[model samples]
Target: MIDAANTYEALFVPALFQQWAPMVADAAKIESGDRVLDIACGTGVLAREAARRTGRSDRVAALDPNAGMLAVARSLAPGIDWQDGAAEALPFPDRSFDVVVCQFGLMFFSDRDKAVREMLRVMVPGGRCAVAVWDAIENAPAFAALVGLLDHVAGRPAGDALRAPFALGERQVLATLFKGAGANSINLTTCKGAARFSNMREFVEAELRGWLPVMGVVLPEPQIDRILAEAETILARYVTADGLAFDISAHLATCRRP
Candidate 1:
């Protein structure tokens, strides 16, 4: 898997995240002078967009548990405040932000309820919080194929995480959590979008290098090659001359702090 900042920035970001960050930011309703925090801000895509909307970097902060992710985030958007932290135990004062946004991060938190409460704690009354989570793995056919392949090859290590990101996809359950966190007027919306990779090979390469779940599985080269070859056929349906194009789904929930 790839580790360098440039490779991740150039390939992985555009392939999976770049297309979705703005959608999350827009739902947050970030405005000028608003202090925004992006929880689990992987490469700081949403945080950077918040900073741009605010016309100042200091007003935008990003937090994540992974040093590698924070490192890449810091290098790309050095102007913003990037903290090394987790979603459950955020290292910030209560009512510290005007908006809280998380992009495909809620499902990965160790304690999603605690994380939701923390997000509400950090936002001012009447402020907005927007969260995005992937829909069920089945809805994203490409990922379904990938995870199925991982399971077929390595039991379950990689496949588990691939499934975790889509765990909190149920609308009623998500809404209940937000309401319990003291957020009112919660609006949950499902969005279907295209996930594009430059090509099938690049898609495989990016997942091998950039996706933690995939890279964490330590298999011999030949075994890995075999897995990749198998995955190729499974994902072949999504590939075109331009690249791999397929419909992916996510749920975006927006709420106002009480």
Candidate 2:
């Protein structure tokens, strides 16, 4: 496992989080004066959103195991209270937050159950804990196509395998995870967004410099370049009257502790 200290910002910051904000905010239900905690708050995307809703009276605490990501978070969203901590072992005391949110971070945890339990432990009674994860490859055709084309062209291990944990989009698993963590009610919902690129080049550029770094473990430089060329070809099909439109889908799970 790569140290959390090293791999967050470049791997997950702008790329993964650009699609997560809306999903998390909708599921977490940020309200005025609500004290919230954003676990794995990569660059403080969710934290900033929550803080905006909470205003000055209340606070939004953003926590992450990655010091690099936390540095970016502090710079990007200074109003948020940024802290260094892991999801499985949160630093806060029990019942510290009215809402605890983890966006795209739950899947990376080594101990998913313990992380869920820790999230609940920090939430006040009746408070909410919400998590967002990516759907399976088939459900996200754009990403699926990208991965397929990349692996085919590069003749390398698929990058999507590294992202397997986030594919747990089933409602049953979401419910069970929360219930086992002492939550009384669980709600699951899906959010879909469109990412428009002028052409395949821009799309490839975004992926290459963005979350593509995360796949470096599986995709080397030569392989990534080959994949990019193939990705451009496949994405050309999606370019129509407007532009290249790729669908981004996420599963949002919200649970309320008894």
Candidate 3:
């Protein structure tokens, strides 16, 4: 799990979806006084944004099993209650929060069913639970183009290291997980955003600094070199009037525990 997390912290956390604070805040639908729990709140992206949206940090609890990631979250949002734990084994008592959220973290849990049940256990009856994951890379054109190029240039080994949360995009599987967790009413929404860079250099830096960990896991060094070369080619496709564009497709899933 730590291996998975190292890759996430490296490849995605900083440059990929960090700017989705507004999206997270908007989706949170937090009341000023609502007690919220952010399970597996990696680096506090959603937790800090949710705190801002809720108008106070005190009402939000950020939980994660990774201390390094939690440390980063704590630095940005000191007032938030940061706890070291996993989604399957929460420290809080039953029905403790008015809202529960997990973003981009559901796909990695060792036991998805147990984790969802734990999330349900901590939520106040009728409270909301929200989870977000990336759409399949195949459906995300900008990313897919880069992936293709990498496979062409970097070879297969480098491309394989970049894989993370591979199962997240399957809607049928996701629906079953929610149903099994006892969330009978589920709402699914899709969000589209873009990651913009001024040039290939900028894009490479963003990915290297932000996504290298995941990339390392999926693609071997030779493949990474090839992938980076392909990334340059893909960047050419998105050269707009101003800069390069990398569009993102994300899934927003919300459910109610009745």
Candidate 4:
């Protein structure tokens, strides 16, 4: 899993996550020497960037629920403090960080309300936080197509894993989530980017082995080829000899603690 994370950072980071991290960091106004915490920081992508912008004073920290992910995070970016934690019960003390950023992680928390409250609880008064959630699977065609193919071949469990992250896709749902947590001046914006891969096969391999959410689904050997065949055909239109590119959409919400 640690090795898988390395590949994930190399391959999927640019294709899926790299753009959003900076957007979140900028929105939160991360400055040099500012203490930053990245909640659910799988592999510390955002934390690492924030650390770069904040200089090498070790003011950056990352936390995640998975030990494997934390191990990978610690190895790749040892400068930041990496801790094992969940969003609903962050391990840090109250009002500890100047800014908090979560990229595509809030939807996976079991108790999102408590998780939002926890985000607020762990930040300094009026601290900024930026979060990005998939707008909708349908809005992101490649992922949606892959998920549909997986459901048809691998069953609903496989598809659900892919769909789960977009559970908070609705803007109102996200707004209410922050508002109910007493967040002030909440502003939600649509962030559009391209989910790029070298090819359809690259996309398949990454999703099967590198993507944390759908990584663990055990498929029969026969079904692996079956699913791939279908996905390739379904995704062919987006593919070129050079690679594949698909428009992806997500909601980036930024707010200040009340």
Candidate maximizing TM-score:
4
Q: Residues 169-226, candidate 1: write the lDDT tens digits.
A: 7888898999888888899999887878888877765665556432355555675687
Reference-based lDDT, each prediction? 0.83, 0.72, 0.73, 0.85
1-258 in candidate 4: lDDT tens per residue? 676777677778877888888888888899998899999898888999999999963899888877777887887888899988889888889999989999989998889999999989988998999988999888987888889888888889888878887888899999999999999889999988888887887788777667734347656668878877888789989987679988988899999887
Which stretches of candidate 1 lie above 4 Å from their native place?
A: 1-7, 213-215
Q: How close is every model to the real structure, measured as TM-score? A: 0.94, 0.84, 0.83, 0.95
Model 3 segments beyond 4 Å from truth? 1-15, 149-161, 214-227
Give the C-alpha miss distance for residue 63 in model 4, angstroms. Answer: 0.3
lDDT of 2 by residue, 1-258 (tens): 133323444444444466677668768888888899999886677888788778842388888776666776776667678988888999999999999988877877889899999988899999987888877667767766776775666444555643454557676877788878788678888888666665666566555554445444444678668766677667777786765776777788898878
Give the best candidate by lDDT: 4
Ranking by TM-score: 4, 1, 2, 3
lDDT score at residue 104, model 2, on the 0-100 scale: 79
**Clashing residue pairs found in predicted model 1:** 1-209, 2-209
